[model samples]
Target: MTQTTGTAGDPPYLRIVATIRRRIADGELAPGDRVPSTRQIAAQWGVALATATKALTTLRLEGLVEARPRIGTVVAGSSPAGPAAPTAPTARRRPSPAPDTEPELTLDRIVRASVEIADAEGLAALSMRGVAARLGVAAMSTYRYVPSKEDLVLLMADAAFGEARPADAYADADVPEDWRARVEVGTRTLWGLYRKHPWLARVGSLTRPLLVPNLLVHGEWMLSALDGHGLDPTTLFDIHVLLYSHVHGLAVHLELEADAEAATGQSEDQWMDSRAPVLRELVDSGRFPTFAKVVGSFEDGYDLRLDALFDLGLRALLDGLTPVVEG
Candidate 1:
């Protein structure tokens, strides 16, 4: 059976590219139909957004899809007549910067470019040199703005976190009143940020937390929810950390999964399938009656749902803490 999600050894991006190519060749997608956005592709195929972006990039390179200014990514040509290429823009000339003039670069621009790079490719693929190359300047030029790659990563993370608001912020102009409800919304908002930016999860840890201002904004919101609940100072803070960890702990897998797919060239299913023989023997050995029975009971094989796990973990954590906070 052709597994829709990461089933073959081929990278997820390649799978996405090949699928689009087939649709084009088979005329299901057609020449001018607007192709799915990266987010859409990620949602539909359960692949990382970076994987989806790479697939679209590959499609562009193969002349199967083209980016239009207002319409977004679409099939290359109306009739497959030599893949539609981007229309040449009206040429404009710029006075080169005076030899003595410093480059028109700023810290914000540097961080923005770095974030863009990390978003499209994982953090490992990011570098001072790469960022400079992307910004069309000398590698050393980036140093003037960002002292080092590590510093750049922190700034990039802060900027990314800055893009999103606490879930409570998205509600009606008036904030949610109940502490539990606010905490739930706040935690989910953090979850959404991690979902949108997988790299953020790897940016910091519990011990070495990212102390960016925007992220602190999120923390304050969560902490405020549990404030004045009669809980001790340490317990209130502990609850906040626990909830953050639950979301972040699961999010780390997002990047790791992408990295694994690229490294092993196998989807999770494909990797698991390789070990099927061993699993089968263990399940059938009859030595572990309980394990075998559990395996045999699945009407449909177990679904490894990180999302469901996230929700369940959040609920369970909240359930455990509700009394502690109110007690």
Candidate 2:
């Protein structure tokens, strides 16, 4: 039930978030308990779905709620001092960086700030001014370390890619049981990184790749695993590229989904609901008998389970490659 909180001045989403946060704090919502989802919050609080989405995002940023695939949001073990607000200013006012008591601005600081901005608002909303505000520096201060937004984005992608590596990178004798295991590790690691930093999927094309050294580390890991097989160099690298593409191609949708949400002010579930009539009409039309028959059979309808699709594609791709590698 929506509360009658007199939230006269504060934003509606923030009020909903505040209510949910209170529930978590009062032990009404235990850790691992299913917290109200965006839709549920919208219905309960009588707010727009967009408002509800922003509210859940705030709770997520605050570390009070965490989203689990297919399970909805849940309470985390503890909440930190709350993450920096993801909401970017609508007006692009250029302000001198505010001084903080911490150390001077550095490359690491610049890249981290850039990543945070891109993560929250998306790449299009990112700017030197926005990043400067984030770092408590002047609008132009970021220019000292990174020349342009494009250059800074390259650095951000590189830093994010380097954040994690396979266990074999550190171990002397430890290795996966087989080549497949090794390849699985590399593929999943790349996918996980994309999941963490959705913007990474949009970086560097295949031919005109991002010339970042850290990203090359992942390449080295994958190539090394594929080397000993009797396959020709062309086939070997081709297979490596294929595996990477499978993960990379699907990952692009992650950023796109975020961008769509921002532009439409509607969540994916909401958008799908809006398009339900057209989908139903297409099924009902007698033009495509086979299509209608297949879709009609789904009790719950087709859920676009991307994670499951990634696994499904990977297994099929590897199965097709087994002969090429073993041949």
Candidate 3:
């Protein structure tokens, strides 16, 4: 087991990297052994997810470890340099000022940097200090453009929502005349955005919605599709929320699955495979005959496809709402 002890002077991530490196050097963790995952590191070291991610990232950059599909990060079979003694903690170094030739910092630049960090790593890995490091600026320098991390995140969400316009999807082609067709176009457009930026699904919810202008563009598109149908105002809005909920509800899992994979070093399939024994035991029990029959009917194991589920759910929902919407 890796010890959590470290000097106060070194950054948390660097201390973690140093500890793991020493383990490799000492053969305590042999080549091909799985490294502790980000979740494990965070829990063991009492640090945030961002710090744990940074530690793993540093180790990967140094050629000390490599990520394997469904297998988590492992010690590199051959490191660039043989494992060496862990260096003692040193004072934290200040980030160098951007050179005279570097681009001037602006609010737009800050938001863009924040979005990039959140996109590449999950939102949990995003930090103001990390953004400053990415831009090669002093950590406090970012505060001038964005008042606080919360404000920066709001700006990031707005910028991300503004990326695609719902109307733009049908711009080149003629807009569909049927209300259902238009609704399909608008809902699918929103789903596409969630796919592009999985972190977006985590931003807001039905109780407290994200009130950004770009997101409103999508709402307007959906409401307008049902405008002339003569449905009551409440019913019209209810239908709109129902459709949005379907997309948002399913899309929320996109980021969650990603985090799960990173934390456990297992893919969805691998995770399900690991649970097969429990499933088999339940099926063998006489208490759930119907459930057993349904499960046993599958020649090949069930594959949970989010895209397929989205399509199926959308079709079913629209079918059920057809009478209410048409009346």
Candidate 4:
């Protein structure tokens, strides 16, 4: 399905289909990977939804993809044909920054551009040059506001974290909800935001935390919620930190799955389906009794449900804290 020619001669819809087909042919798009939604394709390629739909329909017609009920459209099979061309280059050479627009390269603009870039691609594809190109500015122009790519990334990370802040009215409210409940609410909100912007988990560092005000507010709220608990501030902070880490850690896998879906067009379920034969073989060996038993049951083996895990972990952690609070 991979086309050697670029988009020049191909019709818009055809080009889109071919590009995705190329990704599929390469290892980039794997079997059971989710295809980009109509809305996503439109936004990403700057095409109309009709055009995107046509392209997606083309994929379906060619036996390359199938629609999954919950996960959307994913690659139909595991062994896709090899791509005729090289992998798509994420970066293109940039000209100089426009002098007129030079003064407008503010931190906010820079951060927003970085987010947009990461939103389209994964965080690994994000770079100063990439952001600058996305902003239609020279790479060096970004450094005027932020000294280095590292600094720009830190700013981008903080800006992303700050996106989950509650309104001032809610911020001031002294609700009677249990501290654990409050923390869980905040953590879930943060996790949802991360789901929206999968790149957020790439911002590393537990200690020497970034000083973004809104992000600090999340920490402040977590700390304040634990006030009545007898645990010292350090221990209280650690728990919240651990909670954040748990969400962030799990988010990385979700992000990768998202990337795999986008890059390969395979849904998690589709992936599991394609790998089921191998998995069944391993499970049949009887080397791991508990795991084998779990894999034998579709209800246990193929659950894409995250709520159960999240709820279970939250409850277990809170249960351990109940004794500390009561004592």
Candidate with maximal lDDT:
3
Assess candidate 4 and give its TM-score to the true structure: 0.66
Of candidates 3 and 1, the better by lDDT: 3
TM-score for candidate 1: 0.70
Tens-digit per-residue lDDT, 1-327, candidate 1: 131222255566656766777677778887778777655677788976545666676677567887553234689875333233223322222213434334578888888877765665566656786565455565477787778889998888888888877754656777767898888888888888887778899999999999899999999999998998888899889888999999999999987876676455578889888988998999988899998898889886667888999999988988898789888
lDDT digits (tens) for residues 190-244 of candidate 4:
7777777776776665775666666777778777777776888788778778877
TM-score of each: 0.70, 0.70, 0.77, 0.66
**Candidate 1 regions with alpha-carbon error over 4 angstroms:** 1-104, 167-171
Per-residue alpha-carbon lDDT of candidate 2 for residues 1-327, written as tens digits (9 for 90 to 100): 222221444577667766777677677888988776554565677876545655665677667877654345679877654323333343222223456433588889888867765665566646676566455565577887789989989999999989888654446867865777788889998898898888888888777778898888988888888888887899889998999999999999998997777556678888988999999999888999999999899898778988999999999988988888877
Poorest lDDT segment (10 consecutive residues) of candidate 2 = 86-95
Candidate 4: regions farther than 4 A off: 1-97, 166-174, 207-211, 262-265, 299-301
Q: In model 1, what lDDT does residue 252 have?
A: 96
lDDT against the true structure, per candidate, is: 0.74, 0.74, 0.78, 0.68
Q: Backbone collision count in every prediction?
A: 1, 3, 0, 9
Across 29-106, the per-residue lDDT of candidate 3 in tens digits comes to 888998886567888999876577667766786788875543456899975653333454333332245655435888
In the order shown, what is each candidate's alpha-carbon RMSD?
Answer: 10.1, 8.7, 5.3, 10.2
